[model samples]
Target: MALDRFALPARLRQSRHASLLLFAATLVLLLVAAAWFTSARSDLAEAYSHVGSRQQALTAANQRQQEAKLRVQLADSARSLVERASAGGFAENEWGERLINISQTPLARDEVNHLLAGMTRDHARIFGADVFELSVTRADEGLFDTPGSKGPPLMLNLRGTLLFRTAQSGSGVAAPVAALAAAPAIAPEAP
Candidate 1:
């Protein structure tokens, strides 16, 4: 029923200096709050930018790691292929026959195709030969379609000249060119 209890005190309500001081302190507090907000927003933006850059760097590092792993796998595959060829009774710089046996399993199809593609694309480089020739034929007369056949269905025949490079006269230069030849045969092994 009475609003007098909520009224300002008489001395403070009548003082202009007190009112001006309160207004100035309020303005200062507002300015300080504005400055703090600006600083906090900028800091938050910088943190976000830093996180984005770090994420990009991490993605790049992961890609590089994956590429390195792929390279290692490719190198290992090449090494194993070369070792198998070497074990097939062919010596370096000699004309000899190499045999590769392929299985006709679904699991081996990709490997077989990859091997054929490599042999066709880089026969000379892969075999370290100067001259190379390749031929493919069916190993059996539709035996794969038969119920009893267990052998592979394809064969590859290769011919080439093998060349072994040698360091010449302690100079790191290659030796003079020489004649070379090589041959490879592929067939299905008995199951």
Candidate 2:
């Protein structure tokens, strides 16, 4: 009995050892599977975050591209407006005649001064023409001292190259032709 208690049967001992080994192996495998699942979940979260950031960057880039395109269109429209204004020959001639008439009118000294200032500022807006080197002076001599007249008769002296649009060239593009406008020293007689 003492020997039996001290030593188990070989088969039973072996079976107990095997069962212990199997339980240890199963615990280790469960731990490994848990670790792998945690790592996979972490990797998946990082990938989702990276995708979100990339999507935001792409949206911002698209917005910037749209803004750049709008700016280009605005610049093209402004250039077209200027080109059209320069192309109209009759409009320029008519604007010149109107300026001549305004200058020939006898107005008060202050009024003439205001008109000259307004002409410089409003020429581009009203006539759609740019006038460089504009000079306004009294046309009639000793007219400032003349009685019953509001002020001296004025003359408009326009000097500088005018931007004229030439006919379509060989490239099918209308080129700007600069022509010097002759400035008359004396004012033309009123019709």
Candidate 3:
């Protein structure tokens, strides 16, 4: 069975311009589709980049919020500790002595010495305390020594330096510090 090659039209057989026109149209369509695809890909990439940056910014903000919260908590805890220390240090009826509230009163020499001795004895971490020097300047001519004084004694200035040593926690342990230092380092175990 032989197929007839001249079955269509005389115009198609005479020239190849129609076939060239068809090819050109197809090429143009392909180029247009390629350009559209490239533009769409670039837009998609830009959108993804924007979304990534937004996510990073959100993560950083959350971390900063957490840090701020932790700082506030720490400050509150420190304030509470200071309040407790102040209250326990100078209680109203401390040392079984019933006296007036002297938190704001200027302390006498004897009273200051008593307080220092009490602190040295009561502190858990302090091993020893020594007052190297105590200097006081009296503003009035005859304040405490005089029998008739209207107001309390006026002190111009008072200065003192306290030298204290902190007690080590594991000083009584069996292993000496020198021996521990001389010992070889142990390798960590594998997981």
Which predicted model would earn the best TM-score? 2
Locate the minimum summed-lDDT window of 10 residues in model 3. Answer: 92-101
Cα-based lDDT for every prediction = 0.52, 0.52, 0.48
Per-candidate TM-scores read 0.43, 0.45, 0.38
Q: Which digits, one per residue and each the tens of the lDDT, describe model 1 over residues 1-191?
A: 24565454555565777888889999999999999999999999999999999999999999999999999999999888877765663334433333333333332333445554544423233343332333224544442353233433344232342233343322454443222222223442422
lDDT of 1 at 17: 71
Q: Please name the candidate that would achieve the greatest lDDT relative to the true structure.
A: 2
TM-score of predicted structure 3: 0.38
Q: TM-score-based ranking, best first? A: 2, 1, 3
Off by over 4 Å in 1: 1-15, 91-191
Off by over 4 Å in 3: 1-22, 89-191
Q: Write the per-residue lDDT of candidate 3 for residues 1-191, one digit (tens) a residue.
A: 12345544555654567788888999999999999999999999999999999999999999999999999999999888867854654321221211112222354545554544533433331223221223334455453464334334333222222222222233432222332233233221221
- The whole-model C-alpha lDDT of candidate 3 against the native structure comes to 0.48
Candidate 2 whole-model C-alpha lDDT, 0 to 1: 0.52
Prediction 2 TM-score vs. true: 0.45
